[model samples]
Every structure is written in structure tokens, then in C-alpha cells.
Target: MVKLTLIRGLPGSGKSTLANTIDAVHLEADMYFVNQQGEYCYQPDKIAQAHQWCQQQTEQQLALGHDVVVANTFVQQWEMQAYRDLANKYQAELEIVCCNGQYSNVHGVSALTIANMRAKWQD
Candidate 1:
């Protein structure tokens, strides 16, 4: 069985950093929408496409008996539930790490970090 770790947090909350620390394949949500040049923003259709792609990638990785770490701000309940359902469907162990913290107290993360992350996912 595969293990799926869902790193959920706000932008600049170090989701990717945590994923890297765990030595897991970091699947950034932005990668689904951003082009190579990082110019075009995410459209509604594109966002949907990216989500489908992520689902497929997760399935593929699990099928290969590899762990998958999803790095994204799964702020919405629906989003988190979707990941949970996927893990259940695949018979993979689902681990959700909520990186929720007060912006004032979160160390090493500044307003600039949040701004930069928002800019990358700007539509």
C-alpha cells in the first residue's frame, strides 16, 4: 500500500519546504496551471484541467507503489475531502498535516513570502 501525505496550508506556509523535508515528490498546485514561461494565468477551464492532471498523477504514483505528497493550500473542506476520498479509493494511507498558524507567529515567513506565492498563482 502507498502512503499519501497531503500538506495543507496557506500560501508561504512552507508546504513545499515540508514536502522537501520528507523527501517526497512535491506536487505544487501551481504547476498544474503555470506554463513553462510562467506567463499565462490560470483560467477556470485550466484550473479544472490541472486538478484532473493532479488526480491522475496521484493515481499513477500510488500505482507504482510510491508515496505522494501534495503541497497545496487545501483551505476548503471540499478540497480536503476530495483528497481523503481519493486515498480511500486507492487504499492508500492518508495523512493530512494542517499547517495552520497565525501569520504573526509563523516564523521565517514574511509578508513578502505570501505576496510572492500569490503572484505565482495570480489569475
Candidate 2:
């Protein structure tokens, strides 16, 4: 059965690491920042576009009847609604996984930013 899994957590959590172990088309909005040289160059201005691109990629994979795993810091309930809608649209089994492991964030997100996200975390 095709499944759409959402892995959510703060930066430095194990979302990406866990996504890698899952047998699916794993995607993350942060991947939008990866350059052709395989370097992560985060642009705060392009965050919205990154998410849109992630959603598009996920939809494409789902349309092909493939399982998908999306890892992102979905702090708010609304941040995950789009994926939920996509799962319904494709009739795929949906799963939500939250990561809480404390590891160094690869993107160098500031402590303040992480604190802010924690404050707004819905669950």
C-alpha cells in the first residue's frame, strides 16, 4: 500500500535522519536549498517556494503510486494540512511522526529560532 509519512520536528531533531531510513521517496523543503554542488545554502526569502516545491514533488510521487516521506519542521497544525489533503486526494495511508532527538542542526538554525518554533509547536 502507498503511504505518505510526515516527519515533523525542530531543526537538529532526527527528522531527516529517520526519513532516510524509510523506504520511500523522502523529501524535505530544506532540500530546495541544496545547490548543484551538493551544498546547503539556505535562503530565508525562498522558504515559501521551498515548501511549494516539496509539496509538488510529493504529489508527483504519489501520483505515480509511490510511497513518500516528508521531513520538515512542521511547528503548527496548519503547516501539515496540505500533506493531509494530498494523502486524502491520493487515498494513501497517512502517518505523522515527530522527532525529538537533540542533535546539532546541520543548517545552523539559531537557538532563538528553535526556541520560537518550540513555543509555537502544536503537539
Candidate 3:
């Protein structure tokens, strides 16, 4: 069995930093949908494909007895439930880290704003 740590936050929310600190396999959703140049260049058709790839990678890491760290803005309840289902199916422990912080003082975005952005992004 593998351990899954789902780090949820918005863009520039330090999800990557947390993933790095844990030394776990980082599955960055932004990398799939956004470019390093901070551009949203992903095609709608490719989103599902990219998510599938992420799921596969997570499973592979778990199979190898490695902890998987999903660094993404999973702000929706359904999104978090999906991860829970995945963990249950794989017999892994699901750990959800809600990366919410003070947006005014923080250099990154806020979880509430991220959630709103995600809702719009999905629509």
C-alpha cells in the first residue's frame, strides 16, 4: 500500500514547496494545464488526458511503495472525494492538506480565491 498526500491550494500557493519539503512524488496539475511562462495553453481535450496521466503516475508510484504527493488546487468537495475513492481503492492512506493562508500578507494566492477560480475554470 502507498500513502497519498493531497496538497490543495491555488496557483502560487506553495503547494509545490510543500511537496518538495515532504520529499514525495509531486504531481503538479498546473504543469499539465499551464506552462512555465504562466500561460494557460492547455487544450480542453487534453485536460482529461492529462488527468488520466496523473492518476496513472500516482498509481505507479504507490505500486512501487512510494508516497504520492498531489499538488493541485482541489478546492471542490467532489474533487477531494475522488482522491479519497482512489486511496480506498488502492488501500492507501489519504491525507488532505488544505493550503489556506492569509492572502494579503502571503506572497501567493488564497485558498478561497483559488476555490472560486477553480469553479470558474471548471465551468
Candidate 4:
């Protein structure tokens, strides 16, 4: 039973941490923050590209009949609609995981930014 899991919350809410532990093909837009040198260099300008890449990878994995997990700060309902559509298209179960605990995010996002994200987040 392939599942499309979406881990949602603020930057420091452990979305990525939980995604990493999943056996499914975990995909996160932030993974694109790593440069070719394997260093974390977040390109704010490339944010859209990162998400596109993540979604593409997820589609590929789903085509292969694999479960897929997308970890991102899906702070609003609209942010998650695409994944929901994809799951429906593939006839896969959609699972939404909400990470609420605040901690230091792996991407080193500022606490202020995390707080803003939390404020923007909606169930």
C-alpha cells in the first residue's frame, strides 16, 4: 500500500527529522539547499525550483509504486493541495503528519523566522 505522506509544520518543527526516519522515498525541498560541494547553501532564489524538483522526484517514485514522503513547511492548506492531487491521481493513501514541537531546524533558520512560520501555520 503506497502512501503519500506529507510532514507539515514550521521550520523547527521536526518535519525533516521525521521524514528522514521514514522508509518511504522521503523528499524535501530543503534537500536542494546542498550545493555540489555537499555544503548547505540555501538559495532563496531557487526555492521554487527546489519544490518543483521535490514534486518531480515524488512523482517518479510514485510511478515506481513506492511510498513517498514530502517534508516541508506546508503552513497553509493550499500549500498541500498539489500533493493531495498527486496522491489522488496515483490512487495512493494520503497521510498528513503535523510536527508541532519547536526546536533547532537543520537548515539553521532563525528562531524569528520559525516563529513567523508557526504563526502562519494552519491545520
Candidate 2 residue-wise lDDT, 79-110, digit = tens:
99999999999999999999999999999999
| Candidate 1 C-alpha lDDT tens digits along 1-123 | 788999877765667678888855667556676677865455656766777688778777877878899987676657767678778888999888877554442334467856665555421
Candidate 1 TM-score versus the reference: 0.70
lDDT of each: 0.71, 0.97, 0.72, 0.88
Tens digit per residue, CA lDDT, model 4, 1-123 = 689999998877888889889999988898888889888899899999999898888889998999999998889999888898899989999999999877877788887877787788787
| Top candidate when judged by lDDT against the true structure | 2
Give all TM-scores, in the order shown.
0.70, 0.99, 0.70, 0.93
Once superposed on the true structure, which residue ranges of model 1 sit more than 4 Å away at CA? 37-45, 101-123
RMSD of 3: 5.1
Number of residue pairs clashing in candidate 3, backbone atoms closer than 3 angstroms, sequence gap of 3 or more or interchain:
0
Residue 6, candidate 4: C-alpha displacement in angstroms: 0.4
- CA shift of 75, model 4, Å: 0.6
Model 4, poorest ten-residue lDDT window? 114-123
Residue 89's lDDT in candidate 2: 96
For candidate 4, the clash count comes to 0
Candidate 3: tens digits of C-alpha lDDT, residues 1-123: 578999876676577777888867888654576677777565767866777777778878887888889987665666667667778878998888876552432334466865686675421
- List runs of model 4 lying over 4 Å from the truth: none
Which candidate, 3 or 4, would have the higher lDDT against the true structure? Answer: 4
CA RMSD (A), model 1: 6.8
lDDT of 1 at 34: 67
